[model samples]
Target: MASQNRVDLDGNPIKPITICMIGAGGFIGSHLCEKLMAETPHKVLALDVYNDKIKHLLEPDSLPWADRIQFHRLNIKNDSRLESLVRMADLTINLAAICTPADYNTRPLDTIYSNFIDAIPVVKYCSGNNKRLIHFSTCEVYGKTIGSFLPKDSPLRQDPAYYVLSEDASPCIFGPIEKQRWSYACAKQLIERLIYAEGAENGMDFTIVRPFNWIGPRMDFIPGIDGPSEGVPRVLACFSNNLLRHEPLKLVDGGQSQRTFIYIKDAIEAVLLMIENPARANGHIFNVGNPNNEVTVKQLAEMMTKVYAKVSGEPLLETPTIDISSEEFYGVGYDDSDKRIPDMTIINKQLGWNPKTSLWDLLESTLTYQHRTYAEAVKQATSKPAAS
Candidate 1:
């Protein structure tokens, strides 16, 4: 029997169990699934728009409790499909949305409606089922508090939602609303409001997680402001690929924007921790990230170059100043965050959860993964030619 706003744990009320992740195929989602499957005894369901392209990411065999998790092909926009999935789940974590800056910029309409509008049914389903809902929110919502050293409680500063955003930060501000793409933040803020309202009025358990700049494997760290097809232009991925090809790392816009990057594993762990403690998480918001480890773009490029040198057995090539001519979302010469860090005081003390993965450890693991994968790919390609 279901209680007022909480679902009973495993037919009992002690250790609440059972969870369904909406976008389990994504980077953070995949990591979260793996973490949950290993640590918890709960029945986990991983849902996504199953496609051949991302099949490896969704493979149940990759998780510890492969038999426990059920993957379903889903498009949140579809009402019936969403309703059916939401009905069977005890707890729901909606990580389905266009999360990246490139995505928000290129597909603004899809980002806005699919996240804010289409997800209405999912939230309603959680409320109706008396199950807990964990909605994924980005730190990008804390738009440009650049070098401002503003805490979570600071007055909301006006900036594009696709940039340095926070969870508690406001979506609306006084300015030429058209100048910046406030639509993305506006949409998320609207959904947050909607969920909060439902949680209060309908007695539903809902939690919001706002993650800061997170980096790791499976992250499409490519160049260009558009989607994946554009190219590998991101400093990290680009540097890794360059090392593979024995090329010099290219620094764009002098690589000055500093950002706090949370390791993929740590980020996923925080999500699972929140899910397990639904009672504490209900109707509460937490900033999930490591605020201490902040690195600038130039520092990132240098670090990648150093990592590449270790694997490639080659000296670091002299990086040259490359002019970014592309007129995409992260336009040319556009100054990004000087230092965007989070204050994890609340999450750490209350939840007793802190990011364990260090920056060096994270970067080394990333470099190693890229190195091994690239080597395997090259070996396969070259060996095939010889066999023929």
Candidate 2:
């Protein structure tokens, strides 16, 4: 759906295409839906179990793009409507999965089933229907960096070759089965292999994306406000919850793990390129991340504390963070990924995409959203008297 207002790099009008966006109510999917509707003439068959995140786009038929977006409330695990939905669209995007890290160790069986087994039919339908598929994987599939195995004082740890993760070259290193933390990574790796094999033998047109900590607003939820009181969300939401409640952010294992985060909007531009130009995206596994924004978890905590204080007009707590062992924080059989920095060769060459937002700027914008969206709700939830 190329409009008069938008065109490809070659100055050609892009055709509008109907997209079957599975998991279309999650953080990434919601943003993608908004972008497509506001900018292009394309239509979306939005499928997901929950639609709260995207309700703003769905309600009030008076909205300009109301007809372009339709929501399907169903689960992929047992729904009979998934195949028909895929049949209706020219493209299918599989984003349905249990992606939280807290579930990896404690709920390994559900994790494996959600990440791997549940995705089998989605891949088969695409392969059988000859439809283009864009599947979302994770950076955890890269596991720990190569430098993690070297001695603590080794000089080669500074070399990028030893740590930077590449799509075609880096080995997928995982811990022992008993560690259990690798359950999510292992499941995701198997799904990637299956997708690659589908393209190899079945001539399926497919693309796999490995996201490295893409962050921004409407990500996950604030515990006890929009989500379960006992739920442990991804790091961004976890830290935001702590800030909103004026509680200390908890760090696991001294917060030594390092990661790079890209703004959700920046990453969405790459997806749009892929949607508009299948010639540049098919049969390739691209690493979508911002390597320039790398930081250790401890450094991230300090930065978040400062940014939250600045955004919320509140003083930082005397103890903004507390350190706990992984065993205590994540429970037994826990493990960690040492470092993750993506090699951007494939994505840059294919889509000409790059992440533009700096860490501080992105955090400021995100925390501002958090403060505005959850601060009052959290206060009300906390002020209530305890039930007997």
By TM-score, who's the top model here?
A: 2
**Per-prediction RMSD in angstroms?**
6.6, 1.2
Q: Which digits, one per residue and each the tens of the lDDT, describe model 1 over residues 1-388? A: 2122433322334454667788887767777766665555666677888433245534658544566677787777764766666767788889887655434445668868876987788888888878789998665555555425445465543343333434455332312344234556667777888899997788888998877767787665433221243554445666665566555555555666677777888887777667766666677778877876778766777777776667656677676224342234254223233446676766775567888887778888888777765655544544564434
lDDT of each candidate versus the true structure:
0.65, 0.93
Cα-lDDT of candidate 2? 0.93
Q: Residue 319 CA error for candidate 2 (Å)?
A: 1.0
Could you tell me how far off, in angstroms, the CA of residue 93 lies in candidate 2 after the best superposition?
0.6
Residues 1-388 of candidate 2: C-alpha lDDT, one tens digit per residue: 3255677756677888899999999999999999998888999999999999999999999888888999999999999999999999999999999998889999999999999999999999999999999999999999999999999999999999999999999999999999999999999999999999999999999999999999999999888888999998999999898889898989989898999999999999988888887888999999999999999998999999999999888998899999989888788879989999999999989888888999999999999999999999999999999998
How far residue 305's Cα lies from its native spot in candidate 2, in Å, is 0.7
